[model samples]
Target chain A: MSMTMTAIVLGMTVVTYIPRMLPFVLLKGKELPSFWQSILQNVPYATLGALIFPSILTFHEDPSFALIGAAAAFLIAFTGANIIITVLGSIGILTVLSLFL
Target chain B: METTAAAQSEFKDGLAAGTGIAIGYVPAAITYGLLAKSAGLTFIETMSLSIFVFAGAAQYIALSLITIGTGIFEIVLTTFILNIRHFLMSAALSEKTEEEPIWKKAAYSFGVTDETFSVAAMKSGSIHSSFMAGLILISYSSWVLGSGLGYVAGNAMPPVVQESMGIALYAMFIGLLVPSLKTSLKAVLLAATAAILNCIFTYSGALSSGWAIIISTLIASISVEMAGRAREKGGIE
Candidate 1:
């Protein structure tokens, strides 16, 4: 890897680690305000939504192909299967689809 | 001698509890490896990410951003924002764990992913460092080793299958998102709002993907909170 790329990885490690570590170091029994708590709680779902959409459509040349695979995933996920199953199950569907295509 | 037996039992319980989380991480970590490969990351670079960062969503975001040539600064900043929830989880965990010296908290705190946090947080009583070591050991090995397995295994795959690995990440994201969506109207609103904002930012060519995601998440989360406040003021919540 180039120096810049390595730097990015190192930087990422630091940034990711700080949030996971800082609170335990700094906070004992104190609590942040509920407003901040509320925002933090919602951030993951919000980020996941942004992460999934439009990009999911753009993954395949045929948007429908991506949508179909995504739909299978959604169906399995709604059934409350875990993350691994949802991913592997959809990949299975797409592999079968790939064979036909 | 007695403490040794108790700690051993706690560790064993942690290992058992972490087993399901370990199993769950495998496919996602494998997919992360494959995607990192296709994104032109070197194997070392890819594994460095899994080993060091170890946060699933942030590493995936890093891959996508790297492909788009985002700067190190932007990537780091995006990671900080995306992972801000760790603050909350770590705070919750600090209270749950038995008091320890600074070094041990630093060590185990580094292992607290969203998965590990929830499992540790929900245990019946005050937690031991030994118990966390077991939980993290099982889950951490699966994530790190599973990623390496994905990269090495990816090399032998047909090129077509390699290309198709892209969809799995999205599918996983959907899997992650929809459960929360099912549980709450706020989750649904937050996701929809963020998706719409991200689509606009991306499709209009107004922002890079890194900035787009950060802005969209902030706006959507704030908006959801505002709507929630409005409802409360109106006596609807």
Candidate 2:
């Protein structure tokens, strides 16, 4: 890695660590208010949702291919397949579709 | 209170439990490694990212940011929002663990990824730092090693195959989101709100991609919560 990339890595490490460590350190003996806890619980789902939508559409040569992959992924995951299957299933579907496209 | 012997035993059990998660991480981590390599990250940079950052979504965003030549400020801010949920996970896990040295707590907190959090949270009874250490060690090592392996594998693949691998990241994201959407209407709305807001921001040239993501996430989360609260106040089911 170059000096700039290394710096970026270090910067990310700091930002990532602070959140992971801060609550464990600060809230060691206490509980968050229920509302805050609820919000926190919702954070992952909301964040993941935002990150995936729209962006996934632009990921392949044809938007349709990305959509097919997304559909495969959503179906596997929604059916409660493990993460491995959910991911590989999407890739598998996309690969097959790519042949025809 | 945990004796040294008991801590040792629990640590063994923790490793055993973590084996399940470690197995689960292999494909996901390898995919991350492959994608990182395809994004033009070096082996060391890719492996170090898994080692240091350890958050999947944040790392993915980092790759996207780097590929787009985003500013450092934007990269840092975008990752901060993506991983801030770890605060809740760590705080919740802390309640489940017995009091240990602040240093120990600090060390284990670094291992608190979304998957590990689910495992630790699902564990019954008070948690032991030694057990946490074992669990974290296995999962962390699996991720770092997997990244290295994936980078090597990506290097061996044909260019056409590698290019198609771009879909892997999007597929990974969809895989993550859909499971939760199955269980919650609130999740569907929050994600839709963020996606729409992000599109508007990006298309209007009002904000860079990083700020667009951060703003959309915050607004979506807050608005969804407020709407839920309003429904509660109005006695709507």
Candidate 3:
């Protein structure tokens, strides 16, 4: 890698590392107020939900098949499937849909 | 010796648990690689990205930024913004993790991608360093390896299949979200509200996807939390 590229890569690594490490490193053995804790706790679910939409629709050029994949995943997951089966089942559904399209 | 054995077993279980995430990562990382190849990144450039950065969405954003001839500073800033949510994830996980040295915490924290954080957050007990190591090893290697393979495979994969791979990660999100939604009304509301807000921010061109996620998550979480408090007071009244 060029020195420039190496610097960019290292820069990226440092920036990403700070966010992931600072909180974990600094917050140990400290108790957050319950209100803030609840907010933090809800963050994972909220983030997951936010991540799924809009992007899911844009997953393909045409979203109809993508919606099918999403639906299939929701149904499977609602039935208590693990992440792997849910992903594979939806992929399987999309593959069939793609075949027809 | 006994402690080493226990840590080994924990690590083994973590590896087993992270397998699902590793599978979900394959297609996305490969897609990133294929995109990187077309954008004119060399194999080393591409692998350096996956190896050093390790955040999928941020890396993709970086690739696009690089492709457009954006400066390194801008690209780095964009990555930092895109991945800012890791702060919350790390904070939440800190509560779950067994207290360890700062160095140990920093080491495993580096691997806390969105999916891994979700997995670790949802698990019932304290997170050990060895368990985190095992979980991250499988997921990280799979992502880096997939990107390399995609760069190598390069346009050989069918178009339909290439696009279909996009659905896998979203499907993983649905799979993760549904059970949480079912168990807690707050979770359902939180998820739905955040999704709606994200869609609004995205289509309206009001916010970047990264900002949209962070804002929507904070808004939905706070609103749901307040609503829960209100309901409890009403029940008492």
What C-alpha lDDT do the candidate models reach, one value each? 0.80, 0.74, 0.86
Q: Considering every candidate listed, which one attains the maximal DockQ?
A: 3
What's the best-to-worst order under DockQ? Answer: 3, 1, 2
Give the C-alpha miss distance for residue B199 in model 2, angstroms.
3.4
Interface RMSD of each: 4.6, 4.4, 1.2
TM-score of each: 0.67, 0.67, 0.95
Instruction: Report lDDT (Cα) of residue B149, candidate 2.
Output: 80
B1-237 per-residue lDDT for model 2 (tens digits): 456788888888778657655665665677789888889998889988898898877888889889999988888888887677677567667767797778888988899876666556645587888888888888888888877888887355554454455555555556556665777798788778878888888778887655666677677777888899999989965
Name the better of 2 and 3 by lDDT.
3
Assess the local accuracy of residue A12 in candidate 3 as a C-alpha lDDT between 0 and 100.
95
Q: State the TM-score of candidate 2 restricted to chain B.
A: 0.66
DockQ of each: 0.53, 0.50, 0.81
lDDT of 2 by residue, A1-101 (tens): 78868888998999899988997788776777877666655555555655665666775567877777777877877788755576567666766666776
What docking grade applies to model 1? medium
Cα-based lDDT at residue B152, candidate 2:
86
Q: Give the candidates in order of lDDT, highest first.
A: 3, 1, 2
